[model samples]
Target: MADPSNYTYPSPLEGYEGLEPLPDEKETEGPNAKAFINPPSKTLSKAYNQFADPITNDTRGGFDIHIYYLQTNASELKFAAELHERIRREFPELRIYRLFEGPVGPHPIAMFEVNVFTPQQFGAFVAWLVINRGPLSVLVHPNTGDDVRDHSQRATWMGQPIPLQIGFLKEMLKRKEQEGQTNGS
Candidate 1:
């Protein structure tokens, strides 16, 4: 029989050992060190939860919970409708948009959008969906001005990751950039 106690694990930092250590607080005395230590503070309109800050923006800080379902499946459609209704009833204060049967705007699948303002509301709503969501994929993202980053980098999934319409998003971004150029010219 093999001895379990004799088993050894590989080191986590096995490859990189040549990297220089970050300057210690005590070592930081000059202007450069001070600049590194105390970086410029971002001007935020309101204080937001640290966990949700990456996703949240200074101007329009909120979350968009998208419940995705297959439109071809009748059962899924019905369930999605019911789920939408339940969410509306439960969170009356939330700005819940109409249940879309087809891909709307940047969404790749048939989904509904739920807008939440505060971190508390977002936490509660997500928790509820985590427990109740069945046979549905959810795309939870924050409105942080940058549409590309919001959909791709800062996105969270409740179920399997359904690929977003990145092409559409990129095209829109390109158009916006062109418009800005034209306006500036």
Candidate 2:
């Protein structure tokens, strides 16, 4: 790819934007728990309960995707919500993990992760890339500074909060509080 902005193709099928595959790549080797990069910020860390499939492939298993992205700086929250609504309208079956809450950090400035339960939903997500962000899309990268290639890193750049991260953060806090109380007792 010469330049990301160079979306205008030459011949009939020269090059098209948004049509290319935005792969969800991850690497898991030698027990590198980094494959599960917890919420980068301590303030953002909490704990909840859920399960992630150790293997993500074409085996009737679920696919978890993390989208690393930044919004059009100072973008209004309403616009983001509207966009999400549009996505739901278009692909109602896709279960999206929202990163934003109010008009701020909730807006999913850097990353949002999603889990797909079926191949059909995965296909819908592929089609969604073209429909929502295929044109002039910047290369989305993880905060970990490594391009992950598996369900270990959810690679969907929709600028929303990952549900599992939120859960983990919440549950971690709960456990810590309980531990403190137990120690005090």
Considering every candidate listed, which one attains the maximal lDDT?
1
Pairs of residues clashing in candidate 1? none
- Which segments of candidate 1 are over 4 A away from where they belong? 1-61, 180-185
TM-scores of the models, in the given order? Answer: 0.67, 0.35
List CA RMSD, all candidates.
13.6, 18.9
lDDT of 2 by residue, 37-129 (tens): 333344521211212233333433355444444455445434445555676677666566575442222222454444555556666675666
Tens-digit per-residue lDDT, 104-154, candidate 1: 777878999888878778879999999888999998888877677778776
The candidate that achieves the highest TM-score relative to the unseen native structure = 1
Candidate 2 residue 136 Cα shift, in angstroms, is 8.9
Model 1 is weakest, by summed lDDT over 10 consecutive residues, at: 1-10
lDDT of 1 at 174: 91
